[model samples]
Target chain A: MSITVQGRQAATTAAPAPPGGRSRGPARVRWAAVAFVAPAWLYVAGFYLYPLASSIRMGFQDYTVSSFYTGVAPYVGWDNYSKVLHDGHFGETVLNTVLFTAGSLAFQFAIGLALAVFFSRRFPLGGPLRSLLLVPWLLPLVVSGTAWRWILDTDSGVLNHVLLNVHLIAHPVPWLASTHDSLTAVTLVNIWVGIPFNMVILYGGLQSIPGELYEAASLDGAGGWQRFRHITLPLLRPVTAVVLTLGLIYTVKVFDVIMILTQGGPAGSSQTLTTFAYNLSFQQLEFGRGAAVGNLLIGVAVVFAVVYLRATREQRQAGR
Target chain B: MSRLLRTSRLFRPAARPGALAALAAAGALTLAACGTGSGSGGSGGAPDTLTEIDYYDAAPQNTQLPQILDECGVRNGVKIKHQQVPRAQFMPKLLQQASARSLPDLALIDNPDLQQVAATGGLVSLSKAGLSTEGLYPSIAQAGQYQGQTYGIAPGVNGLALYYNTDFFTRAGLEPPTTWAELAADAKKLTQGPRYGVAFSAVGTEEGTFQFEPFFWTARGNLKELDSPQAVKALTLWKDLVGSGSASKSVVTWTQADVNDQFMAGNAAMMVNGPWQLPTLNADKKLHFGVVPIPVPSPDAKPVTPLGGEVWTVGHSKPAREAKAVAVVKCLLSQDESAKWSKDAGYIPSNQRAAAQLASADPQLAAFVQEVGTAKARTTELGTAYPKVSQALADAIQAVLAGGTSPGSALSQAQSAAKN
Candidate 1:
């Protein structure tokens, strides 16, 4: 945003002071701007726009393996969408995707906020401790996911071992091997992976609020909870909104973590829309239906963003 | 309209509607040009170096296969650039390359996937390239065919066998079991603290189905009749194994490699795996293992297993490059090389005579060699539809083993699922 302002200032200052400064100056500056932005524009067009357009177009065609080579895909209109929507596993998959995303976000945010509030107080080793919290975020998802897989293994896992020794349960839980627990197991891992991001963002938000508000509130007989309620929560709303919005987007399309841990398995109990789309496209070789599922996922993300934006807007208006 | 007029007047003084139309046409042409077409390379003239790709990213084969490719490249008078991708990513990578019309000059595709890749019309017919499947196992030869034309040919092949820890069997006063009843009884007896009696893959992938096929086929389960009684019985065997505490519940999550790791670590007394694990198992000098054909329902019943191997296919490219690729394939499939590859890579030779020689020379591989005689190709019955059916079957196994679904009902669901 600042770069754009700087660029505009430079362009204006240079526009009228050149040799052919009156008529051709603005056009030349505009052409120069276009030249500067061409690489980025071409990159967006080639990578993002082209693939998104292809995926959407593919959803309306009977694309298949042969279609890739022959470049011949007959139009099928709504057939792919209808077929995916009517699949026997579709309802279960949607439910799983919802539960996985909601469970991950709620816990991640709550725990992250608590930790951020705790870390707001200065103490010895606080800097190092806060930096250490970023380890999960720093590691590649695949590497951490694989490590989690071992830690969650049923009979041999350290988790079950510790749980058994602590007498938490009578039997070792089949974390990845049972259909009943696989979804919860994957969600727990995702929450663990996401908490670091939530914490770092919310922590930054917590730091930006003025200490004077808390000091004044305390001076006026406002207790800890009262001060936090009146000052902290209201002040952190915008940052909270950004954190949750990005969190929702990231969690909705999480593919690698679940893939590495479960592959949506133990009889598809953990299968989500992202993995389902992938399975349809690559595993089953039904590219059209896969693209349709992919489009539906995009619809889901868009719906979430719109509803969230509207709710936050209403909240801001009400705040005034 | 005003914005457009201002922009055009600022940019060009002589702009007109015709000129705008011409510019739009030029832009559309440029966009269309960006769309996929024949990919770069292998153009202008056929190069002397041919490209080859495979998923042999494991030890022994990973290191050994490149040497073989170099030898074949020398024999064919062309330099071969061999590339290997991980097993899971191999098919997706190949499909992507195919769509871009930039398939490698040669590809060693898994046997079951050959039909799917060939169906894309991205592979050169081996017959047209002057290659023959003569002397290869009939099942292997059939595996390479798509629409009655041979698109690939295998130098060597493999099939599942029961690898047992000899130390466990000896300590327990047990003999190698040849029938399902004895196998189950022995597995129960072998189960002890911190150890499973048996381990096999039941993961949600083709490897899971590949590991399950011996029991499935030995029970006379047909791929087209997935809900038949035979299929239910096969699934029930696996469920009973886990339920009886002879197999771990974790079998549903294990790949063949994981199962092998369990068996090598003494956590599993026996494993259902292929000959490709021999090198790794042998590397552990303390592990004393013996191989046998997967058990049958009765002593008289024959054990039928799926043939597992990779087949070399010449990819569609310039005529000269394809001819050179085919020559390399032919060299790789010659009788001497076939026997050598079978020995070095822990596979059974696809050629009957070469296999017979290998079996006698290496008594340890006799079980796999013998199984290959009766082994069937996964794609022979369903062709390109096999992968879908295989996935359905894998899901049924996981359902029965992990989801607690009855075998009959799970297979029934799988059958209906595969139909679409």
Candidate 2:
């Protein structure tokens, strides 16, 4: 509380002071502000920034399993990157990552939005049902992935058993084992795992939309769809932007799901960039190439971050 | 417009403190979750105490190993602080510690991974440490060697063999097959509605490759050439079983544990597994399983399975600490101690002389012990390159069984991939 008061007082006091003396006013206030942010700054720098920088630097070096112990990896500029780019699996992996991210986001968002709107029309047990929906998001991804793996088993899984008993299909589908089906299977599992996150965020957004706007729109002769189109969506634009931007960042790094489900197997049909990087580093001990793939992944996340920052800035300015 | 902008819900400085507090709470939670494990009590140049680590998280190894370690610790005149990590995290943890130069005084490493760890030059050669492996199986001893220097040794070892449901064989009026052809015919004849005739791991892991190697090596497939006709023959056998529905398509996902589960659940009449499953199988009072050498291509073709087990290794430490660790290893590998460990852990003693006596006393382990004489060290030919090749072979098995690819082409592709 005092920090804010100090900041405001310094800003006011600095304005009237001479140029040379003005720095003294804000400098004292700045130190107080920095004190408030120090812990968070240290957290981000240690966990995120340091690891990212090391990964990028390692990508240019000839790192291997032995390098970890010896700490003697030599730099051979661009060699790791070239190897990753020219690799035959790289193109297909990129396509898989794109399809996985796009498909998961589209379904997760659409289904989540629909559910959010439905729940907005409060009914019996509404609050309980909303809380129940968050169970998926609360569980560890490893536990969820293992449960889904059992459910999607080819021969004895409950899914195939039910489908076959109901005569939904003549033959059982190999959900996890087949190359053609694994991508779809993992994506479906990821969608299930991701839906609760979307629903909760969207539900919060829905609740914050004032009820009077709908009432006012209805009085203006705006029907259900018309009111939704004019009032609800426009008001929800900021929330939607926040949701989709965060969703893109999270989905692009989806590793644990695909890993536990298939380990990106069956001739690497379901391999994504994240699992590919893991395989290169852990399985094959080609740490440099793994870091290169990891850097490429960071590039993807950075692109989304830049676009989000720009769009949100524009949204803020346009609101004026 | 400016008043609206100033009062807009978007610029809710009122919410900023709450968000930051929540973030701080989250950061605290994450930090707590990722907190480093308490530093192990024994450290650098310590004479009176030493540290030992291994992945023995399951019974009876979990129970049995600690007892033996305690005894050895007492005999070695030092207090041993033992730690157990989960199996999957064992190698990654060891590597991290190696990088930090903070490895335990002694580590129990999987035999196939021995070469990879040894190659990092962070292990003290047993010979240099004045440790002798005089009575151990040559292959078992050889598994712990890299570039002709012994770095580790095991008290007991394991290998894969065919474990059949004896009741199923008696009911079907048949004998356990000695050759691949009879094995297939018996498997088909025994298969009933909703029950697979056989189960094995083809689960895209080292275990899957471990199970595959009996046939692979019997047909003369070497680690160097994955695309050889012998390798394809081995893969084709797996394909034929799954394609014929004698083995479930789920074999592509089943680990050895899962295969044992299927056999115990009556979903399968036979499984290819190791001595490690004996205790679990015996725990089910109704289940009766028998062991045999894994069937080869023909009656006379020798079944060459891969040697399996963890070897006790001395990590680089001060001379006194390493000497203490070596004494503990020696105590663990003594003839009497090895025999007791083999009995309790369901493993065959690595000392061949001790194993022979144990085999006569316990017929359940005879087949695996016999195979030990012929079982190939997975790291022998390719050393550290073996893991990449094994991974390729595992993927090839998955492709042929689950992806419907032909064995010939799948193995060739694996060969190409591994070569690159």
Candidate 3:
């Protein structure tokens, strides 16, 4: 009896069933679709949409414990956003955020692509080498930041010790003391943490491409560089887009690296938008202004997402 | 129908299972509550007490607190559960928890943040708890008092003091500085190599403000009277110290740990640090140091230090827990416990009698105790504005030390910033 019912259900539910054939009612179909999507819809509503709305609401008022019971947070529309925009360090923080994001993405992708290409070929200790490369990503952010800070310390860092012993420079450089050096140091650490992700993603992309396509190119007398540029690069476009978009979004929200390394200092030289927002809210207790800054971050991420989606859609159409 | 069933396979069973389990749990909890409420209410039984105390401490767990708590709890017959949070995150976390009406029963609050808590009705008034504020060091107690009511109580005291390396002084053939001019001159003489004569945590935040306060007080300047000629002189002394290369530019960003590291490495001859660093210094065999009251720029001026410390207070709404909270606080703040805590933690005692009792045992603590009497608690109103005010001061100091701006101009900018 169960086998006969299962066969009838399968025949009725098959796509493009013969016209007027035995079929489940549309109401049943709609209910099934709702049942399938309800879990994800609930999850997004509970976590993402709820918090986003709360943050937006909080951005308009001086929402604090002191003001909560009194219900006296005067609505100063756009004032918080205006104040943050006009702050003296606003320009510098924006610039730092852009530079950090662009720099990390560029270096991480380049280094990772090279590693992926190298690892795609069979080599001695290939498995172990790949595992070792994953160590930085395996460590927690705090541990990585702290280890980097120690290694980059001005007086006692191992980096300085090695360089000075090798007679690389006459003076010990303060890696975190100056604005430029601190940026470089933090970028180095970010690149270190970011490379493994890029490698794994790109390697998977590389493995998916057919060997026949490359063999055909080689038969046509294609050079190594030409094969990489014409074949590998073109094939990796989708992965590249994903990597760059994700990397940009992640780097723009950088906090722990800067916080643990320089704390947006020697003179607020390394302050990024996220750290600025953090300081404004927690340290200065200016929640409205912090939320304004955070909203700006969301706006940036949205813009990047739109651009990435457009690019990916264009690539897919061209492939078709 | 089969395709629809396959597509919704994961969700159909999950929804039903979750709903059933939640309903069952709720029914069980309701039944359990009914049973408990009907259970025996014995008058002879100990009170059902669960108190959560939030402790903002950076001290290592291996030291004083566990031992002190064990001894005190046995004596007082109370078991206190402490949740240790880092000092930097404590205030903000407490503020969030306060808004949710879930503040801990007791908290170790900083002096500056205490005003905000008091303003928000986050703390309970100690007088309401039957605790007397009499015979307390007025300045120390001033930290926890808001609107003429004591909302918190200082367990111990910390203040800025001049720490000089005896070896550096001997090598430079100079005595420990007694005045600002002497300090500068000594610093210049001792700064022969990579080593600096003096170091102060002029980094942004309370550290710079605390270090700068003595200079301002010594020159007969005050925070309220920023435009005073004395203030300029005091400001210039700091400018000259950094300007002349007697102090390292590192001071602009150095924390207490940085100052200690420099002193330990013998890179700095003198530092204006708090009592918190004393334990580390004393434990180090390579260094011989002496602690003295911070000197003023003017020889005739009385030396002044800035008083700082933590306070223990219960949440405002926890009346039922008040009896146990008071018992724990009283036990912890008793003269014996306070003295032991002061000695062990390298902080001055909040209780004057306890301070004297500890001083007789440790001469180093005596110097700290003597300084505490002269220490000035930051103005109550100004303390409330500390987060903003301190940041402004730190930025100004950083600017001056980094040679990007002059002290006079920096102070003017800082005053404007502080006003906002």
Candidate 4:
């Protein structure tokens, strides 16, 4: 029975290959390939595809805690989506999400590029300093966020203390406590967390560029700014595209830093779409509405991903 | 092939680890929902053990409650496996279990949440199972009922009270405030460098609503009419406290636990908190604190604090297993056991007789015991709709305190939100 089963598996593995390849060795290779690919395919199907599909389905259903027990979530067909979209708080949440993502990406990429260029030049202690910069990226966001929360506490926080001593302002800033400042405070912490990630990737891309290009630019009597602008910028385009697209995806869905710091409030002032969705589902038990918000976020990420893929494809074709 | 691998590696990037972290963080809620739903219980016949779950993830209760459960289990001729999750995750986890039909045989749920969970039809009607609320406090008994069926029963219950530093009050030569006027005046007098006159949670969660409800109810504010003049007045009191710097602007961000920490650190002269802080407070030998009923709107008005505590519940399961669980719950809620649990856990005994004895014996509990008599159950008026109103109330409190929104406007907005 074992031999027959093995024969059947071998036949299945060989059937999908090119018409020329039917030998035992090639069939065994094909079987090994199946063995190699099976786990990843199963993992993607189980973790990503299944949950994504369930979330989409939930968005169109009137799911509640009662629905969980009775296994009867009545389909509502866009009611959840329409309700959340037209809700009073929805517009503010969308604005917050956009501000947070744009602010974090713009500053993170700028600071990261500057650091990457600065570190590219050989200097004393450069290697150790570059490695040390990664400490922020390595630590969990929860830890970083908690530390920042203490630092930003309005009354006795170290940031206020330093600012007071330096005469930066007359009074302390209510960083996480006031609606006006909470979003800015969370955005600042997010940029701090994201800088190291951006720097390391851009730095790696910098290393891959041939040093001879700089030498050729210099021979042509190109100044430092000219060489960096004309040569380095164009060469770094692909890496920069990857960095920004990935950064957008990561930043738009940021929940922990905001949660640990402000919990998406001082009256929902810092609430982005991610935290809003969480509040809907878990806090209010409006699971369908929460799923709708989550789907909207996923739509944003999908739009950016498609844009990135198309841009990269065009670049490839242009290169050819 | 090599070129293709290099191109794919470019897309993957060295930020692969960071990308993976983002994925894990983003998927947290969905992943929690996707937990394995295997029906993890006995197949048939009489099971010799039962499962219990609760959110008693703090020190005395975390260590003490399980020992009590084991004692009850031993008496009932069954072994018990007890589990705990953090408070925030408790309901979500329970709903997950209910969906799978693998709920623990026994559950200890928070009182205000009883109606919502019971509405899911996942709990056994304890009244039908021969459990009685005969001698329990009326508020606690009412909190455990859903649509006239008793689905839960508390061994002990608690309510919010004002916690003040006795040392600060003595130095300031003032009594603990009894009316809103005195409370505000005393709070302002107590304010000095690095010390706020008072502190309380206004964080945007149910704890905020729980802390604020005493004031709201005392001012004759009804949960059903959140934007009523009385509701606006109740919120205005909090706004004035923060606006006057008698309370920290940071109250908008503080939780009850944070309020306790500030009170202990001498950063705040007083705080609105619950009896649950007693164990932690008493553990600090140097801190001298006193508890009093939260100040009322007038000397003539009764302070109506929200009832707070957890209740023991039986879950749907095999009759034999559920019967055993009910026996364990009865043993846990017996007069002697309830008194002992209350003492160990810093809760007011749900039984009036036991609570009276406890209050007489322990001075710190006297205030809480007095309030629990007239304390209102949060869900009695709104039933399963209480959580939404509570959330709206919490948001109004935060908005009035932190966002500079007038109390009238905030409550008006909250009223609309609760309506939705």
Per-model TM against the reference: 0.91, 0.90, 0.85, 0.91
Candidate 3 local distance difference test against the native = 0.75
Q: Candidate 2, TM-score vs. the true structure?
A: 0.90
Cα error of candidate 1 at position B328, Å: 0.8
Off by over 4 Å in 4: A1-38, A215-221, A315-320, B1-44
Question: What TM-score does candidate 4 reach?
Answer: 0.91
Pairs with backbone N, CA or C atoms under 3 Å apart (clashes), candidate 3: none
| lDDT digits (tens) for residues B13-108 of candidate 3 | 447556544544555455445533412122434324324444535553225776776676677665655566665677777776665555666677
Deviation in angstroms for B105 in model 4? 0.9
* Model 3 bad stretches (over 4 Å): A1-36, A68-72, A117-127, A165-168, A206-232, B1-62, B70-76, B192-195, B224-246, B381-383
lDDT of 2 by residue, A1-320 (tens): 76578678887877777766547667655555555555465577557865777899999999866776787899999999999998767998999999999999999998998889988997999989988998989999999899999899887789999999999978889898888898999999999988998888888888999999999888889998898789878888888898899899999999999999988876677899999998888777788999999999999999999988988898889879
lDDT of 1 by residue, B1-420 (tens): 234324444334344345444554555466444432322345656566888899987888998898898998887777888889888778888877776677888889999999999999999999877788888899999999998899999989999999999999999999988988888999999999889999999999999999899999999989998999998988888899999999999998998889999999999899899999998999999999999999999889999999999999988877767777788898999987887787888899899988988789887899999999999999978988999999999999998899999999999999998997
Of models 1 and 2, which has the larger DockQ? 1
Q: List-wise, what DockQ does each model earn?
A: 0.42, 0.27, 0.30, 0.31
- TM-scores of chain B, in order: 0.91, 0.89, 0.85, 0.90
Interface RMSD of 3: 6.1
Residue B220 in model 1: lDDT = 95
lDDT of 4 by residue, B50-82 (tens): 888999877788888988998898888888888
Once fitted onto the true fold, the runs of candidate 2 whose alpha carbons sit more than 4 angstroms away are A1-40, A208-231, B1-46
In the range B1-420, model 2's lDDT, one tens digit per residue, is: 234323333224456555555555666455444432222334565467777889988888888998888898888777777899987678877887777665777899999999989988888899777777788889888899988889989889999999899999999998998899988898898889888999999988787899999999999998899999889898898899888888888888788988989999999988899898888788899988799999989877889999999999888766667777788888888888888888888899998888889888888888998899999999988888888899888989998988888999989988887887
Native-referenced DockQ of model 2:
0.27
True contacts kept of each: 0.54, 0.46, 0.20, 0.55
Docking class of 3: acceptable
